[model samples]
Target: MKEFEEPTLSADAVLAGLSLAGRVRYAAVGLAGLTVALLVGALWATEPSLPLRTHVAFGGIVAAGLGWAGFAGWTLTRRVPLFARDRVIAGVLALTFSGATAVGLVLVAATRGGTTAVLTASATGLVLVTAALALLVTGRRRRAELLRRKAALTGR
Candidate 1:
């Protein structure tokens, strides 16, 4: 008589099985979700004036976000020296850039005949961006701590 056993996989093993291309796909999907969110938010909160140019711009923004997400994920996984620093800077830049974009979108959406909508959208975008920036700083600090620990343990 012979007994057979099934193989078990560890979490690390499962994650390692995911190729870089797969990771990129996953990130793109996430970016797509965010794009949908932004589009929905725009439609929900502002007046309706959807145009072809606006849709195209939104698509571009989503593509950019997808690229950024893939790059960020790849860098995080590779864990190269100074990647954390770079991530933090990039994240801050992303927050500011996206925030500005959101403001512009909101303003255009709200534009009925005046700048009141623009001002309101700008304020909203500022708050959202500041929060995102704070999150980026926190992530950077965590990465810095991890790097310190690694250096100490390896005596590098």
Candidate 2:
């Protein structure tokens, strides 16, 4: 039986894979997230009568939205040269956001006596954190592989 091998990509092929349209989409998403976060933060700041729980929820939303925007901005600015590095950064951002979200959800659930809705949300948050962790590990491995390939190609 023959073993299947992964196809090796050249630097040109990697660059060619990056699409202008994709970058534009990322920019749009980033802008939208930033705008939403700003609006929410403004509303939260202005509302003096909001309960502590409401404030905490609003803060979490703003933080997560800002994180998403930051990742998107990084992706848009980095271009093709740092695609692997960008992935690693994205993974880190995702992990941070998801882990925070998971912790927050767990706290909320604990405070609320573990209501079904809160528990479900907590579970979802945990799933997201797990996925983010997977992304981080995969990104690191891919970056290592790319570096090794580059070193070999350059006879370093």
The candidate that achieves the highest lDDT relative to the unseen native structure: 2
RMSD of 1: 8.8
What is the C-alpha local distance difference test score of candidate 2?
0.80
1-156 per-residue lDDT for model 1 (tens digits): 879988985333333334578557646655665666576556544745667666656655655565555555654465334424544765775686667677666757576535777777777777778887887888699767857766665578
Off by over 4 Å in 2: 1-18, 115-122
Best by TM-score: 2
Error of 2 at 136 (Å): 1.1
Give the range of the ten consecutive residues with the poorest summed lDDT in model 2: 10-19
TM-scores for all candidates: the values are 0.51, 0.74
Q: Alpha-carbon error at 137 in model 2, in Å?
A: 1.5
RMSD of each: 8.8, 8.1
Error in Å for residue 154 of model 2:
2.0
